[model samples]
Target: MKKIIITLSIALSFALPSYAFADQAACEAKAVSKDGKPLYGAAKDASIKKCMGDAKPNDCEAKAVSKDGKPLYGAAKTASIKKCEGGK
Candidate 1:
């Protein structure tokens, strides 16, 4: 039991840092990558482009959909469509 406990503790030490350091709130704001993988922890809008292959933030749109792949603004890509979507 002593050896088992030590082994588990060592494993948790290695794994916990990566898991504990992530901020869940920031990750929710930005949608996942093109391949449908959630980006790590809630990052600023610009961070959406980083850690997911280092693309320029401005190069991509803020996704017409939410992180869960729901159409936020329908098929509309224009300001008018956005206004309707936002119920403005």
Candidate 2:
């Protein structure tokens, strides 16, 4: 049992950092304006905040797909969609 717990803990430590970095990248990518210009200062912050807040499940469908081309389901799907949508 201890080994299993330690293994799971180690796996999660590696897994979580990737998700965090991915989310930061997504937020930065979404912080741009529709006119192809990058926002700055409070505007950039606001844009990132809005983009994350307005994220929807459908918005992340493409990113939420499984390796076999099937849509993900349940919590995994939800987390994937949220991550893709730039939500924390």
lDDT of 2 by residue, 2-82 (tens): 999999999999999998778777997878778988889999888776755656666687679888988889998988877
The list of candidate 1 runs beyond 4 A from truth reads 21-88
lDDT of 1 at 34: 72
Q: In order, what lDDT does every prediction score?
A: 0.53, 0.81
The number of clashing residue pairs in each candidate reads 4, 0
Q: How well is each residue in 1-88 modelled by candidate 1, as lDDT tens digits?
A: 9999999999999988777446433444455667777655554444644433343333333554466776555355455344433432
CA displacement after TM-score superposition, residue 81 of candidate 2 (Å)? 22
Badly placed stretches (over 4 Å) of model 2 are 54-88
Q: Please state every model's RMSD to the true fold in angstroms.
A: 15.1, 10.9
RMSD of 2: 10.9
